[model samples]
Target: MIGAPMETKGLNANRESKPNRSRKEIIEKKKAMDALLKAASAEKDHLSAFPAFRRYQTNGLSAFLESGRGDKLASSVKHYIQNLLKANMEGLYGSEWPVEERVKRREMVAPEARYIFVREASNASASEMSTMSEQESTSASCVEKRGPMVGFVHFRFVIEEELPVLYVYELQLEPHVQGKGLGKFLMQLIELIARKNQMGAVVLTVHRSNSVAMNFYLSKMRYGLRRVMKFFAKHSVMRLKLSWRYVSVSTRNHLRRFIWFNKVVNSTLFTKGQNPAIEVLEWIIQFQQNALIIVI
Candidate 1:
Protein backbone atom coordinates (compact mmCIF):
# COMPACT_ATOMS: atom_id res chain seq x y z
CA MET A 1 0.00 0.00 0.00
CA ILE A 2 2.84 2.43 0.86
CA GLY A 3 4.70 1.65 -2.37
CA ALA A 4 1.51 2.10 -4.41
CA PRO A 5 1.18 5.76 -3.25
CA MET A 6 4.82 6.40 -4.20
CA GLU A 7 4.29 4.85 -7.66
CA THR A 8 1.19 7.00 -8.25
CA LYS A 9 3.11 10.14 -7.25
CA GLY A 10 5.96 9.22 -9.62
CA LEU A 11 3.60 8.68 -12.55
CA ASN A 12 1.84 11.99 -11.88
CA ALA A 13 5.21 13.77 -11.81
CA ASN A 14 6.20 12.29 -15.15
CA ARG A 15 2.90 13.40 -16.71
CA GLU A 16 3.40 16.91 -15.38
CA SER A 17 6.93 17.09 -16.73
CA LYS A 18 5.81 16.36 -20.32
CA PRO A 19 3.64 19.46 -20.55
CA ASN A 20 6.30 21.52 -18.82
CA ARG A 21 8.88 20.41 -21.33
CA SER A 22 6.56 21.12 -24.24
CA ARG A 23 5.76 24.51 -22.81
CA LYS A 24 9.45 25.31 -22.48
CA GLU A 25 10.03 24.29 -26.11
CA ILE A 26 7.15 26.47 -27.27
CA ILE A 27 8.54 29.45 -25.39
CA GLU A 28 11.99 28.89 -26.85
CA LYS A 29 10.55 28.69 -30.38
CA LYS A 30 8.61 31.91 -29.89
CA LYS A 31 11.72 33.66 -28.58
CA ALA A 32 13.74 32.47 -31.57
CA MET A 33 11.08 33.62 -34.04
CA ASP A 34 10.81 37.00 -32.33
CA ALA A 35 14.57 37.42 -32.46
CA LEU A 36 14.72 36.48 -36.16
CA LEU A 37 11.95 38.95 -37.12
CA LYS A 38 13.52 41.72 -35.02
CA ALA A 39 16.88 41.25 -36.69
CA ALA A 40 15.34 41.13 -40.18
CA SER A 41 13.26 44.27 -39.62
CA ALA A 42 16.19 46.14 -38.07
CA GLU A 43 18.28 45.82 -41.22
CA LYS A 44 17.56 48.97 -43.25
CA ASP A 45 18.77 47.64 -46.58
CA HIS A 46 18.79 44.04 -47.77
CA LEU A 47 20.49 44.81 -51.10
CA SER A 48 23.34 46.56 -49.32
CA ALA A 49 24.24 43.20 -47.80
CA PHE A 50 24.50 41.88 -51.36
CA PRO A 51 26.60 44.44 -53.17
CA ALA A 52 27.21 41.98 -55.98
CA PHE A 53 23.51 41.81 -56.71
CA ARG A 54 23.29 45.59 -56.90
CA ARG A 55 24.22 45.57 -60.56
CA TYR A 56 22.85 43.08 -63.10
CA GLN A 57 24.49 43.42 -66.50
CA THR A 58 23.93 40.81 -69.16
CA ASN A 59 22.33 40.40 -72.61
CA GLY A 60 22.72 44.14 -73.32
CA LEU A 61 20.62 44.90 -70.25
CA SER A 62 22.19 46.85 -67.42
CA ALA A 63 20.38 47.71 -64.21
CA PHE A 64 21.04 48.61 -60.57
CA LEU A 65 19.16 47.88 -57.36
CA GLU A 66 18.26 50.38 -54.63
CA SER A 67 16.17 49.91 -51.54
CA GLY A 68 12.92 51.74 -50.79
CA ARG A 69 10.13 51.77 -48.22
CA GLY A 70 6.49 51.55 -49.24
CA ASP A 71 5.39 54.34 -46.92
CA LYS A 72 8.10 56.63 -48.26
CA LEU A 73 7.38 55.92 -51.91
CA ALA A 74 7.23 59.11 -53.97
CA SER A 75 4.06 59.89 -55.91
CA SER A 76 5.80 59.14 -59.18
CA VAL A 77 7.03 55.79 -57.95
CA LYS A 78 3.56 54.89 -56.68
CA HIS A 79 2.06 55.85 -60.03
CA TYR A 80 4.62 53.72 -61.82
CA ILE A 81 3.85 50.75 -59.60
CA GLN A 82 0.12 51.08 -60.17
CA ASN A 83 0.50 51.28 -63.91
CA LEU A 84 3.00 48.44 -64.05
CA LEU A 85 0.78 46.18 -61.98
CA LYS A 86 -2.16 46.98 -64.18
CA ALA A 87 -0.21 46.41 -67.36
CA ASN A 88 1.13 43.04 -66.24
CA MET A 89 -1.73 41.72 -64.14
CA GLU A 90 -5.03 43.15 -65.41
CA GLY A 91 -5.50 40.55 -68.12
CA LEU A 92 -5.14 37.83 -65.54
CA TYR A 93 -7.54 39.45 -63.06
CA GLY A 94 -10.10 40.53 -65.69
CA SER A 95 -13.00 42.40 -64.09
CA GLU A 96 -11.56 41.99 -60.60
CA TRP A 97 -8.56 44.31 -61.16
CA PRO A 98 -10.01 47.65 -60.05
CA VAL A 99 -11.04 46.27 -56.66
CA GLU A 100 -7.79 44.41 -56.39
CA GLU A 101 -5.88 47.54 -57.36
CA ARG A 102 -7.42 49.47 -54.52
CA VAL A 103 -6.45 46.75 -52.07
CA LYS A 104 -2.91 46.63 -53.45
CA ARG A 105 -2.54 50.40 -53.21
CA ARG A 106 -3.48 50.23 -49.56
CA GLU A 107 -1.13 47.33 -48.96
CA MET A 108 1.71 49.07 -50.77
CA VAL A 109 1.59 51.95 -48.30
CA ALA A 110 1.94 49.78 -45.21
CA PRO A 111 4.90 50.89 -43.10
CA GLU A 112 6.26 47.34 -42.98
CA ALA A 113 6.46 47.09 -46.75
CA ARG A 114 9.95 46.88 -48.32
CA TYR A 115 11.03 47.39 -51.91
CA ILE A 116 14.03 46.69 -54.12
CA PHE A 117 13.82 49.04 -57.06
CA VAL A 118 15.52 48.01 -60.29
CA ARG A 119 16.63 51.00 -62.36
CA GLU A 120 18.23 51.41 -65.75
CA ALA A 121 21.99 51.82 -65.37
CA SER A 122 22.76 52.10 -69.08
CA ASN A 123 21.83 55.78 -69.14
CA ALA A 124 22.79 56.54 -65.58
CA SER A 125 23.88 60.16 -65.07
CA ALA A 126 27.48 61.04 -64.22
CA SER A 127 26.58 61.36 -60.54
CA GLU A 128 24.91 57.96 -60.53
CA MET A 129 28.00 56.42 -62.19
CA SER A 130 30.11 57.53 -59.24
CA THR A 131 30.32 55.03 -56.38
CA MET A 132 27.51 55.35 -53.85
CA SER A 133 29.21 53.43 -51.06
CA GLU A 134 30.33 56.65 -49.35
CA GLN A 135 26.78 57.93 -49.51
CA GLU A 136 25.32 54.50 -48.68
CA SER A 137 23.44 53.72 -51.92
CA THR A 138 21.17 51.37 -50.03
CA SER A 139 19.60 54.09 -47.90
CA ALA A 140 15.91 54.55 -48.78
CA SER A 141 16.23 58.22 -47.87
CA CYS A 142 19.20 58.80 -50.17
CA VAL A 143 18.03 60.64 -53.30
CA GLU A 144 20.20 60.05 -56.35
CA LYS A 145 19.54 59.98 -60.05
CA ARG A 146 18.42 56.44 -60.79
CA GLY A 147 17.80 55.98 -64.48
CA PRO A 148 14.18 55.21 -65.36
CA MET A 149 12.84 52.45 -63.09
CA VAL A 150 12.58 49.16 -65.01
CA GLY A 151 11.40 46.82 -62.32
CA PHE A 152 10.69 46.51 -58.58
CA VAL A 153 10.15 43.79 -55.97
CA HIS A 154 8.09 44.48 -52.87
CA PHE A 155 8.54 42.03 -50.02
CA ARG A 156 8.21 41.81 -46.26
CA PHE A 157 9.44 39.57 -43.45
CA VAL A 158 6.58 37.99 -41.58
CA ILE A 159 5.73 34.83 -39.67
CA GLU A 160 3.78 32.30 -41.74
CA GLU A 161 2.71 28.93 -40.40
CA GLU A 162 4.85 29.58 -37.30
CA LEU A 163 7.92 30.02 -39.52
CA PRO A 164 9.73 33.23 -40.38
CA VAL A 165 9.46 33.95 -44.10
CA LEU A 166 10.22 36.65 -46.64
CA TYR A 167 6.90 37.16 -48.38
CA VAL A 168 7.10 38.73 -51.86
CA TYR A 169 4.01 40.81 -52.51
CA GLU A 170 4.95 42.20 -55.90
CA LEU A 171 7.57 41.48 -58.56
CA GLN A 172 6.69 43.76 -61.43
CA LEU A 173 9.09 44.29 -64.30
CA GLU A 174 8.55 46.41 -67.36
CA PRO A 175 7.66 44.25 -70.38
CA HIS A 176 10.79 45.47 -72.14
CA VAL A 177 12.98 43.96 -69.43
CA GLN A 178 11.32 40.57 -69.39
CA GLY A 179 13.20 37.40 -70.53
CA LYS A 180 16.65 38.97 -70.19
CA GLY A 181 17.59 36.85 -67.12
CA LEU A 182 16.80 39.84 -64.87
CA GLY A 183 13.82 38.12 -63.30
CA LYS A 184 15.88 35.08 -62.42
CA PHE A 185 18.61 37.30 -61.04
CA LEU A 186 16.17 39.19 -58.84
CA MET A 187 14.64 36.01 -57.44
CA GLN A 188 18.06 34.56 -56.74
CA LEU A 189 18.96 37.69 -54.81
CA ILE A 190 15.69 37.56 -52.86
CA GLU A 191 16.33 33.94 -51.88
CA LEU A 192 19.81 34.91 -50.69
CA ILE A 193 18.33 37.67 -48.57
CA ALA A 194 15.88 35.22 -47.07
CA ARG A 195 18.64 32.76 -46.25
CA LYS A 196 20.84 35.50 -44.81
CA ASN A 197 18.08 36.47 -42.39
CA GLN A 198 17.46 32.84 -41.33
CA MET A 199 14.05 32.87 -42.92
CA GLY A 200 12.50 29.46 -43.43
CA ALA A 201 11.11 30.24 -46.87
CA VAL A 202 10.38 32.85 -49.55
CA VAL A 203 6.65 32.88 -50.22
CA LEU A 204 4.47 34.46 -52.90
CA THR A 205 1.21 34.04 -54.75
CA VAL A 206 0.56 33.57 -58.47
CA HIS A 207 -2.65 33.73 -60.44
CA ARG A 208 -3.86 30.64 -62.30
CA SER A 209 -4.46 32.54 -65.52
CA ASN A 210 -0.90 33.86 -65.64
CA SER A 211 0.84 30.91 -67.23
CA VAL A 212 4.03 32.76 -67.91
CA ALA A 213 4.34 33.93 -64.34
CA MET A 214 3.46 30.46 -63.08
CA ASN A 215 6.11 28.81 -65.24
CA PHE A 216 8.70 31.41 -64.33
CA TYR A 217 8.25 30.84 -60.62
CA LEU A 218 7.72 27.08 -60.41
CA SER A 219 9.99 25.97 -63.25
CA LYS A 220 12.72 28.57 -63.24
CA MET A 221 12.72 29.67 -59.60
CA ARG A 222 12.26 26.25 -57.93
CA TYR A 223 9.21 27.34 -55.96
CA GLY A 224 6.64 24.68 -55.04
CA LEU A 225 2.95 25.26 -54.53
CA ARG A 226 2.12 25.71 -50.87
CA ARG A 227 -1.68 25.63 -51.23
CA VAL A 228 -4.59 27.36 -52.93
CA MET A 229 -6.05 30.18 -50.92
CA LYS A 230 -9.64 29.51 -49.90
CA PHE A 231 -10.88 33.01 -50.58
CA PHE A 232 -8.75 33.66 -53.63
CA ALA A 233 -9.67 30.68 -55.75
CA LYS A 234 -7.89 32.14 -58.73
CA HIS A 235 -4.59 32.41 -56.88
CA SER A 236 -2.22 29.78 -55.60
CA VAL A 237 0.45 30.27 -52.96
CA MET A 238 4.00 29.38 -53.98
CA ARG A 239 6.97 28.94 -51.69
CA LEU A 240 10.65 28.23 -52.09
CA LYS A 241 11.84 26.64 -48.89
CA LEU A 242 15.22 28.15 -47.98
CA SER A 243 16.33 25.52 -45.49
CA TRP A 244 17.67 23.43 -48.35
CA ARG A 245 21.38 24.01 -48.89
CA TYR A 246 22.23 25.43 -52.29
CA VAL A 247 24.19 23.10 -54.51
CA SER A 248 27.02 24.60 -56.57
CA VAL A 249 27.55 23.53 -60.19
CA SER A 250 27.96 25.10 -63.63
CA THR A 251 24.80 24.89 -65.76
CA ARG A 252 25.39 27.61 -68.30
CA ASN A 253 26.67 25.20 -70.91
CA HIS A 254 23.97 22.70 -70.12
CA LEU A 255 21.30 25.37 -70.40
CA ARG A 256 22.70 26.57 -73.72
CA ARG A 257 22.66 23.05 -75.10
CA PHE A 258 19.11 22.39 -73.84
CA ILE A 259 19.83 18.66 -74.18
CA TRP A 260 17.89 17.59 -71.11
CA PHE A 261 15.50 20.51 -71.16
CA ASN A 262 14.24 19.38 -74.54
CA LYS A 263 13.13 16.07 -73.12
CA VAL A 264 11.03 17.51 -70.25
CA VAL A 265 9.03 20.14 -72.08
CA ASN A 266 5.79 18.19 -71.69
CA SER A 267 6.23 17.65 -67.94
CA THR A 268 6.03 21.11 -66.32
CA LEU A 269 3.14 22.92 -64.62
CA PHE A 270 2.19 25.19 -67.53
CA THR A 271 1.02 24.74 -71.14
CA LYS A 272 4.36 25.82 -72.55
CA GLY A 273 6.69 22.85 -72.19
CA GLN A 274 9.36 23.19 -69.48
CA ASN A 275 12.09 21.02 -68.06
CA PRO A 276 10.73 18.53 -65.54
CA ALA A 277 11.23 18.29 -61.78
CA ILE A 278 14.55 16.56 -62.37
CA GLU A 279 15.45 19.59 -64.42
CA VAL A 280 14.41 21.67 -61.46
CA LEU A 281 16.91 19.68 -59.41
CA GLU A 282 19.55 20.37 -62.04
CA TRP A 283 18.70 24.09 -61.74
CA ILE A 284 18.88 23.84 -57.96
CA ILE A 285 22.36 22.42 -58.38
CA GLN A 286 23.54 25.23 -60.64
CA PHE A 287 21.50 28.08 -59.15
CA GLN A 288 23.99 29.03 -56.43
CA GLN A 289 26.91 29.02 -58.81
CA ASN A 290 25.50 32.08 -60.55
CA ALA A 291 25.27 33.98 -57.28
CA LEU A 292 28.50 35.96 -57.58
CA ILE A 293 29.10 38.77 -55.12
CA ILE A 294 31.17 41.88 -55.88
CA VAL A 295 31.26 44.25 -52.93
CA ILE A 296 31.97 47.68 -54.38
Candidate 2:
Protein backbone atom coordinates (compact mmCIF):
# COMPACT_ATOMS: atom_id res chain seq x y z
CA MET A 1 0.00 0.00 0.00
CA ILE A 2 2.84 2.36 0.87
CA GLY A 3 4.65 1.68 -2.42
CA ALA A 4 1.43 2.24 -4.43
CA PRO A 5 1.01 5.72 -2.90
CA MET A 6 4.63 6.63 -3.74
CA GLU A 7 4.14 5.51 -7.37
CA THR A 8 0.91 7.53 -7.62
CA LYS A 9 2.78 10.62 -6.32
CA GLY A 10 5.51 10.14 -8.91
CA LEU A 11 2.92 9.89 -11.73
CA ASN A 12 1.30 13.09 -10.52
CA ALA A 13 4.63 14.89 -10.56
CA ASN A 14 5.34 13.90 -14.22
CA ARG A 15 1.82 14.91 -15.29
CA GLU A 16 2.31 18.29 -13.67
CA SER A 17 5.75 18.81 -15.33
CA LYS A 18 4.68 18.09 -18.91
CA PRO A 19 2.86 21.39 -19.40
CA ASN A 20 5.79 23.30 -17.93
CA ARG A 21 8.21 21.51 -20.23
CA SER A 22 6.01 22.15 -23.26
CA ARG A 23 5.66 25.80 -22.33
CA LYS A 24 9.41 26.09 -21.90
CA GLU A 25 9.94 24.57 -25.34
CA ILE A 26 7.58 27.07 -26.95
CA ILE A 27 9.34 29.97 -25.29
CA GLU A 28 12.77 28.69 -26.31
CA LYS A 29 11.63 28.25 -29.91
CA LYS A 30 10.28 31.78 -30.06
CA LYS A 31 13.55 33.11 -28.68
CA ALA A 32 15.59 31.16 -31.22
CA MET A 33 13.48 32.48 -34.09
CA ASP A 34 13.91 36.01 -32.88
CA ALA A 35 17.64 35.54 -32.56
CA LEU A 36 17.97 34.15 -36.05
CA LEU A 37 15.99 36.99 -37.55
CA LYS A 38 17.99 39.53 -35.58
CA ALA A 39 21.30 38.10 -36.74
CA ALA A 40 20.26 38.01 -40.41
CA SER A 41 18.86 41.53 -40.40
CA ALA A 42 21.93 42.87 -38.62
CA GLU A 43 24.19 42.06 -41.53
CA LYS A 44 24.63 45.04 -43.83
CA ASP A 45 25.27 42.97 -46.92
CA HIS A 46 24.26 39.37 -47.34
CA LEU A 47 26.02 39.29 -50.71
CA SER A 48 29.27 40.50 -49.19
CA ALA A 49 29.62 37.05 -47.72
CA PHE A 50 29.84 35.69 -51.29
CA PRO A 51 31.89 38.05 -53.43
CA ALA A 52 32.09 35.76 -56.44
CA PHE A 53 28.32 35.72 -56.72
CA ARG A 54 28.22 39.51 -56.67
CA ARG A 55 28.97 39.67 -60.35
CA TYR A 56 27.49 37.44 -63.03
CA GLN A 57 29.32 37.59 -66.36
CA THR A 58 28.43 34.72 -68.62
CA ASN A 59 26.44 33.73 -71.71
CA GLY A 60 26.84 37.22 -73.24
CA LEU A 61 25.45 38.95 -70.14
CA SER A 62 27.34 41.11 -67.64
CA ALA A 63 25.76 42.36 -64.45
CA PHE A 64 26.50 43.20 -60.81
CA LEU A 65 24.21 42.96 -57.79
CA GLU A 66 23.23 45.61 -55.20
CA SER A 67 20.95 45.32 -52.20
CA GLY A 68 18.24 47.69 -51.01
CA ARG A 69 15.08 47.75 -48.98
CA GLY A 70 11.72 48.42 -50.59
CA ASP A 71 10.87 51.22 -48.19
CA LYS A 72 14.25 52.82 -48.81
CA LEU A 73 14.12 52.48 -52.60
CA ALA A 74 14.24 55.68 -54.63
CA SER A 75 10.92 56.69 -56.17
CA SER A 76 12.27 55.91 -59.64
CA VAL A 77 13.18 52.34 -58.62
CA LYS A 78 9.74 51.77 -57.14
CA HIS A 79 8.21 52.93 -60.40
CA TYR A 80 10.61 50.66 -62.22
CA ILE A 81 9.60 47.60 -60.20
CA GLN A 82 5.93 48.43 -60.79
CA ASN A 83 6.43 48.90 -64.50
CA LEU A 84 8.68 45.86 -64.95
CA LEU A 85 6.42 43.50 -63.03
CA LYS A 86 3.42 44.79 -64.96
CA ALA A 87 5.12 44.36 -68.29
CA ASN A 88 6.19 40.83 -67.40
CA MET A 89 3.10 39.56 -65.59
CA GLU A 90 0.04 41.71 -66.36
CA GLY A 91 -1.15 39.61 -69.26
CA LEU A 92 -1.13 36.49 -67.11
CA TYR A 93 -3.69 37.91 -64.67
CA GLY A 94 -6.03 39.43 -67.26
CA SER A 95 -8.91 41.26 -65.50
CA GLU A 96 -7.54 40.53 -62.04
CA TRP A 97 -4.50 42.71 -62.60
CA PRO A 98 -5.79 46.01 -61.26
CA VAL A 99 -6.60 44.48 -57.88
CA GLU A 100 -3.40 42.47 -57.87
CA GLU A 101 -1.44 45.58 -58.70
CA ARG A 102 -2.92 47.36 -55.74
CA VAL A 103 -1.90 44.51 -53.48
CA LYS A 104 1.60 44.51 -54.98
CA ARG A 105 2.00 48.22 -54.43
CA ARG A 106 1.34 47.82 -50.73
CA GLU A 107 3.55 44.78 -50.44
CA MET A 108 6.49 46.39 -52.22
CA VAL A 109 6.93 48.95 -49.46
CA ALA A 110 6.59 46.73 -46.42
CA PRO A 111 9.41 47.39 -43.96
CA GLU A 112 10.63 43.82 -44.01
CA ALA A 113 10.97 43.57 -47.79
CA ARG A 114 14.55 43.08 -49.08
CA TYR A 115 15.67 43.67 -52.65
CA ILE A 116 18.62 42.48 -54.72
CA PHE A 117 19.00 44.57 -57.87
CA VAL A 118 20.96 43.62 -60.98
CA ARG A 119 22.79 46.40 -62.77
CA GLU A 120 24.69 46.40 -66.03
CA ALA A 121 28.44 46.15 -65.58
CA SER A 122 31.05 47.57 -67.92
CA ASN A 123 34.05 46.27 -65.96
CA ALA A 124 34.91 44.58 -62.67
CA SER A 125 35.36 47.87 -60.83
CA ALA A 126 32.46 50.04 -62.08
CA SER A 127 29.05 49.97 -63.78
CA GLU A 128 27.81 52.13 -66.61
CA MET A 129 24.80 54.15 -65.58
CA SER A 130 21.89 54.40 -67.97
CA THR A 131 19.47 57.24 -68.69
CA MET A 132 17.06 56.23 -65.93
CA SER A 133 16.90 58.81 -63.11
CA GLU A 134 17.16 56.33 -60.24
CA GLN A 135 20.29 57.82 -58.75
CA GLU A 136 20.24 57.58 -54.98
CA SER A 137 22.57 59.41 -52.58
CA THR A 138 24.25 56.39 -51.06
CA SER A 139 27.71 56.14 -49.53
CA ALA A 140 30.48 55.77 -52.08
CA SER A 141 31.95 52.72 -50.38
CA CYS A 142 28.65 50.79 -50.55
CA VAL A 143 27.71 51.24 -54.24
CA GLU A 144 29.44 53.13 -57.04
CA LYS A 145 28.38 54.06 -60.55
CA ARG A 146 25.42 51.66 -60.50
CA GLY A 147 24.33 50.93 -64.05
CA PRO A 148 20.85 50.61 -65.46
CA MET A 149 18.77 48.21 -63.43
CA VAL A 150 18.19 45.12 -65.56
CA GLY A 151 16.59 42.91 -62.92
CA PHE A 152 15.65 42.74 -59.26
CA VAL A 153 14.75 40.05 -56.74
CA HIS A 154 12.56 40.76 -53.73
CA PHE A 155 12.87 38.29 -50.86
CA ARG A 156 12.39 38.12 -47.12
CA PHE A 157 13.57 35.89 -44.30
CA VAL A 158 10.45 34.64 -42.60
CA ILE A 159 9.27 31.85 -40.35
CA GLU A 160 7.06 29.42 -42.23
CA GLU A 161 5.58 26.16 -40.93
CA GLU A 162 7.53 26.85 -37.72
CA LEU A 163 10.81 26.85 -39.63
CA PRO A 164 12.86 29.81 -40.84
CA VAL A 165 12.94 30.32 -44.60
CA LEU A 166 13.68 32.91 -47.23
CA TYR A 167 10.59 33.65 -49.31
CA VAL A 168 11.08 35.15 -52.76
CA TYR A 169 8.31 37.62 -53.45
CA GLU A 170 9.35 38.73 -56.93
CA LEU A 171 11.99 38.00 -59.54
CA GLN A 172 11.60 40.54 -62.32
CA LEU A 173 13.96 41.13 -65.20
CA GLU A 174 13.78 43.52 -68.12
CA PRO A 175 12.71 41.85 -71.36
CA HIS A 176 16.10 42.43 -72.88
CA VAL A 177 17.80 40.58 -70.06
CA GLN A 178 15.62 37.47 -70.35
CA GLY A 179 16.97 34.15 -71.77
CA LYS A 180 20.53 35.05 -70.81
CA GLY A 181 20.71 32.76 -67.71
CA LEU A 182 20.27 35.70 -65.33
CA GLY A 183 17.07 34.32 -63.86
CA LYS A 184 18.65 30.98 -63.06
CA PHE A 185 21.65 32.69 -61.59
CA LEU A 186 19.42 34.84 -59.41
CA MET A 187 17.57 31.75 -58.11
CA GLN A 188 20.87 30.08 -57.29
CA LEU A 189 21.94 33.14 -55.38
CA ILE A 190 18.64 33.07 -53.52
CA GLU A 191 19.26 29.51 -52.45
CA LEU A 192 22.69 30.44 -51.20
CA ILE A 193 21.28 33.32 -49.22
CA ALA A 194 18.76 30.96 -47.63
CA ARG A 195 21.49 28.51 -46.69
CA LYS A 196 23.81 31.19 -45.37
CA ASN A 197 21.10 32.53 -43.13
CA GLN A 198 20.46 29.04 -41.74
CA MET A 199 17.03 28.90 -43.29
CA GLY A 200 15.45 25.51 -43.76
CA ALA A 201 14.41 26.24 -47.37
CA VAL A 202 13.57 28.84 -49.97
CA VAL A 203 9.94 29.43 -51.04
CA LEU A 204 8.20 31.41 -53.78
CA THR A 205 4.81 31.64 -55.47
CA VAL A 206 4.21 31.69 -59.22
CA HIS A 207 1.29 32.08 -61.55
CA ARG A 208 0.11 28.94 -63.32
CA SER A 209 -0.60 30.72 -66.59
CA ASN A 210 3.01 31.74 -66.96
CA SER A 211 4.12 28.46 -68.48
CA VAL A 212 7.47 29.74 -69.57
CA ALA A 213 8.33 30.91 -66.06
CA MET A 214 6.86 27.69 -64.65
CA ASN A 215 9.00 25.54 -66.89
CA PHE A 216 12.05 27.67 -66.23
CA TYR A 217 11.69 27.12 -62.49
CA LEU A 218 10.91 23.40 -62.51
CA SER A 219 12.96 22.30 -65.53
CA LYS A 220 15.89 24.60 -64.94
CA MET A 221 15.89 25.73 -61.31
CA ARG A 222 15.01 22.40 -59.67
CA TYR A 223 12.52 23.98 -57.29
CA GLY A 224 9.95 21.41 -56.11
CA LEU A 225 6.28 22.06 -55.52
CA ARG A 226 5.48 22.19 -51.84
CA ARG A 227 1.68 22.54 -51.92
CA VAL A 228 -1.29 23.26 -54.19
CA MET A 229 -4.78 24.32 -53.17
CA LYS A 230 -7.47 27.00 -53.33
CA PHE A 231 -7.12 30.39 -51.67
CA PHE A 232 -9.72 33.10 -51.14
CA ALA A 233 -12.39 31.00 -52.85
CA LYS A 234 -15.19 32.80 -51.03
CA HIS A 235 -13.92 36.23 -51.93
CA SER A 236 -15.30 37.98 -55.03
CA VAL A 237 -13.98 40.85 -57.07
CA MET A 238 -15.32 42.81 -60.04
CA ARG A 239 -15.75 40.64 -63.11
CA LEU A 240 -14.83 41.37 -66.71
CA LYS A 241 -15.46 39.72 -70.03
CA LEU A 242 -13.01 37.37 -71.69
CA SER A 243 -12.90 35.56 -75.00
CA TRP A 244 -12.19 32.15 -73.41
CA ARG A 245 -14.95 29.61 -72.81
CA TYR A 246 -15.71 26.35 -70.92
CA VAL A 247 -15.37 27.76 -67.42
CA SER A 248 -17.69 29.58 -64.98
CA VAL A 249 -17.03 33.19 -63.98
CA SER A 250 -15.87 32.34 -60.45
CA THR A 251 -13.78 29.46 -61.67
CA ARG A 252 -12.17 31.60 -64.32
CA ASN A 253 -11.47 34.34 -61.82
CA HIS A 254 -10.09 31.88 -59.32
CA LEU A 255 -7.90 30.36 -61.97
CA ARG A 256 -6.70 33.78 -62.97
CA ARG A 257 -5.25 34.23 -59.50
CA PHE A 258 -3.96 30.69 -59.14
CA ILE A 259 -0.68 30.67 -57.17
CA TRP A 260 2.04 28.04 -57.17
CA PHE A 261 4.37 27.58 -54.22
CA ASN A 262 7.89 26.46 -55.17
CA LYS A 263 10.54 25.42 -52.68
CA VAL A 264 14.21 24.64 -53.19
CA VAL A 265 14.99 20.93 -53.05
CA ASN A 266 15.65 19.95 -49.46
CA SER A 267 19.26 20.71 -48.54
CA THR A 268 19.74 17.33 -46.92
CA LEU A 269 19.28 15.66 -50.29
CA PHE A 270 22.59 17.06 -51.50
CA THR A 271 25.88 15.40 -50.73
CA LYS A 272 28.22 17.16 -48.33
CA GLY A 273 30.77 19.62 -49.79
CA GLN A 274 28.98 19.77 -53.16
CA ASN A 275 27.73 23.16 -54.35
CA PRO A 276 23.96 23.21 -53.88
CA ALA A 277 23.32 25.47 -56.86
CA ILE A 278 25.31 23.23 -59.15
CA GLU A 279 23.57 20.17 -57.78
CA VAL A 280 20.19 21.73 -58.40
CA LEU A 281 21.13 22.55 -61.99
CA GLU A 282 22.29 18.99 -62.54
CA TRP A 283 18.98 17.65 -61.21
CA ILE A 284 17.07 19.69 -63.78
CA ILE A 285 18.28 17.66 -66.77
CA GLN A 286 16.55 14.52 -65.50
CA PHE A 287 13.14 15.54 -64.15
CA GLN A 288 10.11 17.74 -64.62
CA GLN A 289 8.74 18.55 -61.18
CA ASN A 290 5.43 20.17 -60.21
CA ALA A 291 5.46 23.07 -57.77
CA LEU A 292 2.65 24.08 -55.42
CA ILE A 293 -0.29 25.85 -57.05
CA ILE A 294 -2.95 27.73 -55.09
CA VAL A 295 -6.19 29.20 -56.45
CA ILE A 296 -6.82 32.59 -54.95
Predicted structure with the largest TM-score when compared to the true one: 2
lDDT over C-alpha atoms for residue 272 of model 1: 17
What is the lDDT for 200 in model 2?
A: 59
Candidate 2: tens digits of C-alpha lDDT, residues 1-296: 99999999999999989988988976887688777777876667777776667777677777778788867889999999999989987898888889888888888898778889998764533433222222321336335654678889998877654456788889999988899999998888888888787765677777877888778877897666423333356432321131111211222234444444546444442332233332432344235432332222
Segments of candidate 1 deviating more than 4 angstroms: 1-7, 122-145, 227-296
- Could you say which candidate leads in lDDT? 2
lDDT of 1 by residue, 201-255 (tens): 6767666566788788767875554332222322222223322222211111111
RMSD of each: 12.0, 9.9
TM-score of each: 0.71, 0.73
- Residue pairs of candidate 2 with colliding backbone atoms: 225-291, 225-292, 259-294, 261-292
As a whole number from 0 to 100, the lDDT of residue 126 in candidate 2 is 41
lDDT of 2: 0.67
